[model samples]
Each structure stands twice: as C-alpha cells, then as structure tokens.
Target chain A: MKTIKGIKISSGVVSGPIFNFERGKLTVPKHFIREADFDSELERFNTAIRKSKDELTQVRDLVHNHLDEDHAKIIEAQLLAVQDEEMITAVRELMVREKKNVTWAYFEVMDDYEKLLLKTFSQFFKERTADLKDIKKRVIYHLSHEKDIIQPEIIKPSIIVAEKMSPSDLMHIDHKLTLGIITRYGGVDSHAGILARAFRVPYISNINRIQEIVSYSEIILDADNETILLDITDDIKASYESRIQDFRRHRDNIISDKVANSTKDGVPYHIYLNAGFVDEVKAMDPALIQGIGLFRTEFLCIERNSIPDENVQFQAYKAVLEKMNDLPVVFRVYDFGRDKLLAMLDLEILQEDHVFDEWGGIGFLLDNPEILKAQLRAILRASAYGNTRIMLPLVMFVEEVVRTKEILETIKSELKREGLAFAENIELGAMIETSSVLEELDELAKYVDFFSIGTNDLALYLLGSGRMTDLTKNYYHPKMFRAIDKIIKAGNKAGIPVDVCGEMASDPYALIGLTAIGIRFISVSSSALAAISDEVSKIDVQQCGKLVNSILNADSAFTIYSHLKKFYHEQLE
Target chain B: MVRKEIKILNKYGLHTRPATALVTLVSKFKSDVFLEYNGVKVNAKSILGLLVLAVEPGANLIVEANGVDEQEAVDNLDRLAQQKFNLE
Candidate 1:
C-alpha cells in the first residue's frame, strides 16, 4: 500500500477506481479484470456498441432531416463500423482471452484499425480520423455513463486523475459519477480546478507521476489530509468509511444550509450565480441565488463546431429562466470575438491590432447581425417565461447599445407579428469591461438598463497597458478599484444598479473592497458562495466602508496592500 | 463461380461511401463475395474489410463470387463500377 500526498483542492474523502483523463484528450484505461468478469465485460462492450449505434442513427437522421443527405452518409459509415461483426468478435476475443475490461478491449481494437487507416496523424486524413475517433469516444462515453447525455448518474463511476484538466474537459465530465479529481500538475487557482471546486467535486493537484499513480486498481482519497491511500487494508477502509460519512455530513450542511445575504448588521445585499453551461443552470437552487447574473452565452456555442440555431439557443435560455423563476436572469448575448471564435461562422481572427477597428464585442455581433438576431430572438422569446435581461458584452460605445436596441425593436416587432409571446419591456444591459466604456459610463448606463462590471477584462485593459506588467499578475489593482468605484458612482447617478460578476467579486479582499464602494449585487461561481458569505458575515458594511475609505484613494499599490492586510488581520482574522 | 477484374473509378476510390456501397451491394446477393488486390483478399460484405484494402482510384481488384446468384452479384457490381461506384 503506497500513500501519496498532494495539495487538497476541495475537501472530501472518496474511494473509487481512478480514471486517467489526459488534458483535452480521452485516453482508454487499460486494466485487467477477473476471468469470471469476462461475460459481464463483453455484455458491457455489446451494450456500448448498441448505444453508439442508437446515437449514430439519431444523429444521421437529424442530419438527413436538417442537412443534406451527404452529411448523413458520413454518419451512416460510422454506423457500419459499429455494426461490423469482425470488430465485435475481436473485442470479445481480446476481453475473454486476456480478462480485460470492456473499454480496454474495445479501445485497443478500434485504435488498431484507426492506426491502420491513417499511418500518420496528418491534415489530409483529418476528416476520416475525426470520424473514427468520434465513434471511439462515443462508445467510451456510453460505457462510462449509464444513461443518455446530460443525465446525472454514471454506471461505473471513476475518480478522474489527470495531468491537467482543461475547462473543455471539465464540461465533458459528468459531476455526479465523478467521485473525485486529482491532477498531477494543477493549482487550486487553475481554471479547471476552480470549475471542479464549483461543481463540488473532491479535487487535489500537484502530485508527481500521473502515469505511475493511475495504474492502481482503486484509490482511497482523504482530501482533508491531502493523502491518497492505495491498497488499503480492511482496518484502514473501516476508519475511512466513518470519516467519509462525517465529511459528507459536514459538507452537506455547508451546501444545503443557506447563509444570510447580508452583512453582520443585516444590511441587505443579493448574491447571484454565474452559469455557463446547462448542467450548472439545471443544478442551481433558486432559493440560494437572486438570479444568474451572467449567463455566459458564448460558452454554449464555443464547445460545438456549428453555430446553434434559434431553437437550440432558445431552449437553453428557456431552461435557465424557468429554473430561476421570477428572479432576474441576465443572458449575455454571444460574446464571441478576439479569443472566442466560432468554427462555422465566417469570421477571421479578431487580432489585437483590430482593437479599435470595428472589432469590439458589440461591433462584431452587429456586423454579424444574424448571430445577434438568433440570440436576441431566443432570449426575447424566453423572456415570456420568467424575468430575463439581455446584456451585451464588451460594449465601448453608446451607439452600439442604441443599434442593439434598434435590432431588438425589429426583433420584438417580428416576434409580435409572428404571434410569439415575449416580454415587451425586457431590460437591456451592457458589460462595463472595456477601458473606453469606463470613461463613458454615465452615457452608456443611460442607454442600458444596468451594468455588470467584468473586472477580469476591466483589469486586463486597465492594468494591461501599463509599464512592466503581465496581465495575469496585474488584477484588482488600486487603479481598477478606482475605475470600479467610478463605474458604481456613475451607475448610481443614472439610477441603474451595478453588479460585480468577475473573479474579483469572489476574492475575499476584493469583495470587501467592492462592498466598501457600495456595490450591492455580487455574482460569483456557486463554489465561492460559502466562503464569500462567511466573510460577509464577519464584518459590517461600516467596517468595509472604513477599510476602503482609508486606502482606496491611496496612490501606491503597496499602501493599499498594507492597509488591506492590516484590515483583514484586524477585523476578519 | 463468377470472377471479374474491376477498377475503382470514384473520386475517393474505396473510401467510406464507395466502401459502404460495395458492402451493401455484395451483402444483398446470396453469394460469398471477395475482393483481392495486392495479394490481400477480404470479404466483400464487410465495409471495414473493403476500407482496409484502401483500393485507390484506377486500382484493379479481382472480384470473385460463388453462390446461387453469383453472376447477378458480379454483373450488378460491374455496372456500379462502370458508373464510378455511383459517386454522388
């Protein structure tokens, strides 16, 4: 029994077979099973193949209906591969002869054929390779999950051990069956780590030899102690079992028990969640949040190769709003440009050189008015169900909002003409992220319903252009706080509420600073709620106001940092 | 028994569409059909087997069949080849 210690990301104790998920790649687990398990393993392999066939047929039919017959033929070929008897026999023989698990045997067989088809993984064979690889991953996905896509539970759940899990990989995994996650080289601050933490998965990182540790049959993870126990004895398992119960009970209390959305003195505030994907939207407890402050719409389209049509986008928006009920849900229009580009959209890379050349978020969307129309149409249609607001991303000009309002007016008129019910007075808001927008905050706020400060981008634009700076390290600068302070005052003057819906909203010291500046609505990932609420409960609004008043006007970062440290130690600690 | 030599004339040769077409056509006839090229022979009824051969355009394959309707299968396949495996 070897025990390895690593940094604990989320606290829990879980015991399960470890699945080695390489970053952005699906790797097949090559593990042996008992000979007595051969029949069941083969059964599992057959079931996976059946599921793959069913999935392919549905997709093929969908293509045939919506697209041309040529696209359907590609899926038909995959269906042929699934039904091929020789591949099935080879898989069964390999599993029965070597007593291997179903996924192991199946992956080996398909991989051998894929290698045969394309000797080198090159551009010329990309389509064929992609087709074959799609079939492979589909079967494996079916084997891992007990039911269809987006369902919570999985059959043979495994703890994911990765070198580094990316955000896309985080989306691929179903949280309910993922017992825990341990990466060889990820910090708790990494994007994937934060996501996993938000999803309430037990996670740890910075362990050596991901390859070495993943070879074990099963693992007992004691994240509370940052210890992984392999080859556990009966006595150790017994002790850990009780420990697991205690840990889950403690954790459940933290999740289910609501914290007051106020300061220590009962000053009222609202806590909202920022959700990107369907699972997060579906899993939200409306009682715990005021609404989803920033429904990242681009996140929905980024994962797919094709642009989602009005119906797809409408369904997604409808799910979120229905879940939120009457709470105001802000669905940000597709924030695509610069780093985020759609594959199917006829768009060139929006380079930094084009920062001011009609390539801003609202500019790009206005240029591609079709994408904007589809999103607006969807959000407006969904508005009939619940309280919905449309927020534009990276707005630098009031004219952009004015033009969007014009487009919305046309869409609303069209929807009304078509007999589609929608909220006629749906509010429109703009994200105050761009530096240019900060200067025109009062004017921009006038054209919009409200403002949600995207501090991540605001800081990047504010501190990014300054001397001797890495955009990553320069966050929540005093200059940024001053900028946010300005945005809040302008928003207050304009009689529109301002929101902080960025990483700064969740960070302890930054949250205190934002609260001090009299920002009331804070939106963060659900994982940050407990900690933020705990900090909120520690001090009154008066203390936060004092803390900010003392140093927010200071010229030096050092002075602000020292003051914040002193304030935290004096009050929070 | 019926045997004939045919050349792959489709744009992608014996790739997915042509391969699937070949398998579907051969599987329908009551015959044991086989395609031999470069000393490698595979069951004509299996798409994977036909694709593994990777018979390129203008490549010749000796198609052999032996069953009650062997002649009909070979005749229909020859007609398909003449039309470039119904490339569309």
Candidate 2:
C-alpha cells in the first residue's frame, strides 16, 4: 500500500474509485477531411454544436433549480454566448477553409477566440475567456469519441482526482456520486474547497503526481488523517472497509440511543442542528435532535431580486415550524449583508464606529424599519403554528434588542388590528458573536430569551480577522476558548440558557472546552453529529472541566494553545 | 427601420445581469436589433455583443432595429436601457 500525504481541507474518511479529470485539455485529435465526406463531417460538427448547447442549457437549468439565480446568471450568459452569431461563423469558417477535423478546427478557433477575449480592455469581456475555454472543452468532448480512455462515464460514486481545476469545473461536480475531491494543487480556502463544502463532500489537496495515479482501481481517502492510500492490498481495503463500517455503526448506535444527547456520566446537552432550510429537519429522526439553534431566514431573501413580503416570509417560516412541530426553532431574521446579499437593497457595507458593527443582522435591519417589521411580523405570525424564537445576528448592544422588541410590539399591534392570529409569546434571543456583545451579555441577557454562541463570527471579531484569511489557524487561538467560557459562565450567572453553535461546536477540542465550561446546549451541522456524539462519550466531563480550568488561567496565548493541543492529542487521539 | 439612443446609467456598467436583461429584452422581437457604443456596433440579441461593448455608466448607446417589429424593438430596448435594466 502506498500512502500519500496531502493537506486536508475538510475532514471525513471515504473510500472510492478515483475519477481522474485532467486539468489540462484532453488531446483533441486532428483529421484531414476528404472532399467526398465533407457533408458528413460538417454534419458531425453541427451535431457537436447542438449537443454543446444542450449541455449548457442542462447545466444552466440544473444550477437554476438547485442553487440560486445568482449562481445561474453566469451560465445564463454562457448559454447566450454558445449561440453568438459571430462565434458560430468563426468555427464553421475555420472547418470549411482549413479542411481540418471539426474538433481541431473548433479548438483552434476557440483557443484564438479566448485569447482575443482575454486581450480585451473590458473586465466584462475579459472574464468571458474562462467561459469561452469551458465552451471549447464541451464542444470538443462531443466531437471526440474517446471517452473511456480519457474522461470515463462517472457512473459510480468516486473521489475526483485532478492536477488542478477551475471554479466552473468544481460547480459541475455530479454531487450524486460525489464522495470527495482531491487535487495536487489548491489552497484549502480555494473556490473549489468552498464549493466542495457546499456540495457536502470531503476535499483535500497538495499531493504530487495526480496525473500518474489515475490507473489505480480504488483508493482510500481518509481526509481526517490527511492520507490517501493507493495501490492497496486486500487486507488494507478490508480494514478501511471495517473502519467505514465502524463509523456507520457508531453513528447508528448514537442516533438510536435516546441519551446520546448526554455525556457518558449523564450530563445532558440540548443537542441541536444548525439548518438553512426545512429539508434538514425533515431528513432527520426528529427525536434524535433537540431543535434548530439557527434557522437563517436569509434563504428567502437570497433567491430572486425582490424582498419577500410579510406573507412569503411567513410561509417559509411556517414550513419549518410545522415540520419541526413541537421542537423550538430559532429564526434569525434577514441576516442579509456581508456575503448574504439582497441586490435590491444596494448595500454599501459602511463601517460603524464599532469594528464589529459591520453591515448585517440587527444593524442592517434596524436601519430599514419596513424590512425589519416585515420579518418580525412573519416570525411572530408563524409562531402560532409551533414553538419559535427570534434571534438577531451581530447584536452588540442591549439597545438593538430593545428596538427589535419595540418593533415586534408595534408589529403585534398591527397584526391584531388586521385580525392576524399570532402566538401570545415568541421568544427573543441574541447570537453572542460580536466582541462588544460579550461584554454586554449580562445586561443583554435581561432583554432577550436565550443566547447562542456564534463562534464563527465571535472568533472572527475577537481575533480581528476575515474568514477567508486562514481562520483555521486563528480559530484555534487560546483567546477563543476563554471567550466561550466567559459567554457560558455569563449565561449561567444571568440564569439564561446559552447554546454553542457555529464552527466551535463541531471542533472536537473546542467542544471539549465547551462541555467543560458547563454549557447546557450546543448545535452543530448534522453531518458531524455521530462523530461529535462519539467524542462526547469518550470525554470524562469531570476531568475536562479541571483541564479547561488550567488552560483558562494561563497567562499567555501560547501557553493556553499548547495545553489545548496536548488535550486534543491525549483525548481525541 | 427605427433608431434610438439611450444612456447606461446603472452604478455597475452593463455587467452580467444587466447585459442578460438587455439581451433578453431585444430577443423577444422578430426584428434584427443592433447596439452602437464606443463606435462599435453589435447584435443586441447576443449577450456577448453587449458585454464586448463594455457599456460603462453614463455612456450613450445608439440602438438600431430593422425588420417587422423594428419600431417596437427600438422603443423597448431604449426603455430597458434607460431603466438601468431595472437593477441596481
């Protein structure tokens, strides 16, 4: 067995056949067209053009249906480019004049076309070079009959092995058979890695000889271990197979175990799921989860141009509430801005005097009373269906909560006047993310119902870093844990329930810190549930608290970091 | 034949979405539509044509149309462009 070391972008252990997609263009074979067969040759070229159009349309529709219109817009423009009168004429003219094979003619013309586009002064036109190159590949693939030898039929679930890839290629990944993606070159924060995470697949990169390893029948991709085992013996295969089985068994055992929400010593956790849509709740056994800690209402605003009116937003929240039924679902209202965009809003992300008070969440909402009221009315209106809570994102002070409550009251009066039935009470909660919010939680908790530690943003603000710039390195900073400990302890003192969510909830060692701090609840992405459950089962809560105490009291960031790393190795290993 | 001139007034130039909107509007009519910007004329029905023009904000674009629906095409295209493709 040959073991290759690589940088793991996201973690999981998967074993599958390697589907090699070459980064460089596949060889476009050339042929001399005979005068006698000119009609047939031209017909074949036309067939390729037609097929390429169909493929672009198919991809466009797929992205439109699955993702959002924003993602679909680029493909929509490409679909128009596919039938551009000038581009089609250039391809046919090349074939007619050169007596060259359709694939070669198409390739030569498109290659030149891409260069022509890249040379253009307009950024809009220059950006089309990538699409032009992609279009060239699609057409050439249909023209060339060599499939099995080059790009095979991706029938089974396989790990994508590539030397390098573009974002468009990553977007075209057939997620049905998507086990994972590994490449010879890419940053963990590359667009491909981001898409891989969006596609819910493990991704790794930085390996050598990606092109040479295509002949292997099957390989094991243990991203968690940062190892890709190749040319595996039967024994190695069977052992990895059992490891997969063991993972599945543990997942099933914990999911089935009613008390999986508790530590081995019977300390209960309000284990919740962080969800974006209704389907995440529908996919799970409802009894296995406590509730959704964070349900982004931004999904309604994301697709299409206009802001969803009160009723449209109301219906979306109602679906989740009815689906979850008895369980409490915290709906974060229109956390739109900073990556979550509403084009109509025309948001200029102006910096407030406070660094953490960047545009989004309560800050953005409070500025637009109409938008805020519409969302407050919807969440409160939906509350009649089931248990619901309203949580504001990026809440730094108690006053924002006060304003939202005032608006909710005003909205409630409007609903009552309009004869709209809303529940008597819908809980108001705050996401403890901003650094300022941390200091104000004691004063803040009095105004809200419960608290959720949004560690992703909390860490970002605390460390004063952007997420794209190596958050994984900064995320482990010792200051992050102390902050969580502070949030949890403050929650305990204030007599309000605090739940940990975002990245820290799933990170094993950070989870250790969280559990040790006597946090009563935490929400994690559903995929990590089984592994997290297993990690909790192994931790002796009593000892973890003692370990965390020393780490917390440490004078230096380096001192605390070393202690946390040591704990991770000793316990999680 | 019919002709009209419109200014691209959107904060962002005729980028992806607005270019798409312009192409979609011109395509609905049976007329042959063309847009002239920066001394370059291009097929109004083709998104690539609009993109290559690189119609920046405040640029005056002359549109021409010929065929059965010429007048209607010219009017709608001019209106859409003036409306900034109804986008920000």
TM-scores, all models, native as reference: 0.65, 0.65
Look at candidate 2 and tell me the lDDT of residue A397: 78
Best by lDDT: 1
Give the Cα lDDT of each candidate.
Answer: 0.74, 0.71
Candidate 2 residue-wise lDDT, A255-323, digit = tens: 564425677677776677776645546666766667788886665443222366778788888988888
* Candidate 1 clash pair list: none
Model 2: C-alpha RMSD to truth?
10.5
